[model samples]
Target: MKANRKLVAAAVGTAIAPVLVLLSPAGIASAHGYVNAPASRQAQCAQGTVSCGQIKYEPQSVEGPKGLHSCDGGNAQFAELNDNNKGWKATPVGSSVAFTWKFTARHRTSNYEYWIGNDKIATVDGGGQQPPETVTHNVDLKGHTGRQTVLAVWNIADTANAFYACIDLQVS
Candidate 1:
């Protein structure tokens, strides 16, 4: 069957290149997608620790073919995230990229563990003063170029289930 008109147009839009962000969060690291997090486990920007991720993606689109499409097609997927880390993804644009994030302790994520691609990204997990903080990083995504979606998941170190997670993807 022929593709829907809107979907075709959207696909063209993605191929042509428009600001495309998956708004998702990673892989090979036991990172679960953010949508999986329980609503009660939701982390407040002002109460939890913040980890940021920078991402880049192959040609995709915010406006792309809808309905069952291929991986190569622009997808509205919530980047997978887990308690292992927190971050944001962005496509290499004109010059630089920016990131801002926070994690709250109020979610009872006792002993929260955080990392950024193998680096310790945070100090406190779920205990202590529930610090509210922010960090900024800039990177050139001219390489590793593909759909870059940062992942952030929250779960007790010894626990199997995650409590909170989030991802912010910037596609261009």
Candidate 2:
């Protein structure tokens, strides 16, 4: 009788072990980040500067697989960001611009890349270390002028994913 009770207890423990592991903090450490300054489309949406859909509530969650040049990180909920005709307000900037990023969950970072069309304008190395709540990068846009959509990517060090944002700018 006692042996049967012990066997049942062990079976229960085995069944619950996987659930505990999935609920652990270590198992759910995905990083969330987005560009705020220069007011990326997500930032503008979050701040109510522009009308948006579900992405306005979770601007920092525009994460997707790396090497993607998309503004919404290929997220269906954020697909509104890919619409260039949505009347997004462009920030006036100079030949050189400073972009500020805000992270809701900072993780070990790989690097940050800024792109204009097919051209990569700037890259800031992270050396695989965890970052602060906010980071700023100064990007040079000397050769490019007028309205441009700059795709910003935040590559994670330990993960195969990255966060993405797009800043609309009217360069003078």
Candidate 3:
């Protein structure tokens, strides 16, 4: 009888092991962040300023492998962000723009990069620490004028992944 009970206990543990792993943080895509101020593409979708599909619901989930240049983070659900003619509202700003980020799930970060075309405008080191709920970086947009798209990347320190946000701007 004791042997049968032990066998049942082992079976239950085996059955629930996969579920437990799924419930673990490491088992899920944990890092979530997005640029908020100046209204990034995902931000516009989340705020109803633009029409989008799945990305509209989880704007902060545009995460993929690091060193990617795509605005959607290579996520098919956020492919609308890659559409240049989607009528994404361009925020008007001066040469210096402060880009704010909102993090849903904070992770140790490596750095934040801002790019305009092939030019890297700014790179703020994260110092391998978890950031606050909201972080802002003032990026100089000098030498850039008129309509432009800024790609912002948040590279995670501990993971080989990064969060992406693309901000459209009408710079002065």
Candidate 4:
């Protein structure tokens, strides 16, 4: 039985070896999160309320103008699960936005969700979190155009250094 198990392990390792080779050192480093729109500040808002930008996949360094911020500032706790998955949220507060948020697990979030004016209309999923790395991130609020109340959340709680984001988006 042990010999059979060894053989199975070897076979699995061999199969996985080819797949692991494609992940560069940088790719491995990015297993935590990704930085979206490092230079651009304007992310589109559909329904004129739900706009987003500079989504960090694994809590990386975010850079923008002084007023531009994404996620909160703190270490991510295990309990901050339902918040924004390293992305920003927008809700039209007299053309701005607002939302309640918390923290989440590292590299565990499958995607993100947003609600514009009480209607949950968007979700950011598998375009980048998977292995291929060719996924894209964007949203279109053409159909559910309504009043928006940005609901932004992130992962930050009971952690050594809390992971956070600036919960604001430059809507267009």
For all predicted structures, in order, the TM-scores are 0.25, 0.83, 0.84, 0.29
What's the C-alpha lDDT at position 58 in model 1?
Answer: 15
Sort by TM-score, top down from the best: 3, 2, 4, 1
Task: Name the Cα RMSD for model 1.
Answer: 18.2
Q: What RMSD does each model have against the real structure? A: 18.2, 4.1, 3.2, 13.9
Task: State the TM-score for model 4.
Answer: 0.29
Q: Which regions of candidate 3 fall more than 4 Å away from where they truly are?
A: 1-31
Per-residue alpha-carbon lDDT of candidate 2 for residues 45-153, written as tens digits (9 for 90 to 100): 9899989998888889999999999998988888999999888899999999999999988989999999998899999999999889999999999589999999999
Q: What lDDT does each candidate get?
A: 0.31, 0.92, 0.93, 0.35
Q: In terms of TM-score, which candidate is stronger, 1 or 2? A: 2
The better-scoring model by TM-score among 1 and 4 is 4
Worst 10 residues of 3 by lDDT: 24-33
Q: Write the per-residue lDDT of candidate 3 for residues 1-172, one digit (tens) a residue.
A: 9999999999999999999998997845654899999899999999999888988888999999998899999988788899999999999999889999999899999999999988999999999999999999999996899999999999999988999999999999
TM-score of 1: 0.25
Off by over 4 Å in 2: 1-31
Writing each residue's lDDT as its tens digit, candidate 1 over 86-159 gives 33232244322333323322223344333333443443345523324432334333432343333233344333
Q: Which ten residues in a row have the lowest lDDT in candidate 2?
A: 24-33
Which prediction has the highest lDDT against the true structure? 3
Residue pairs in steric clash, candidate 3?
A: none
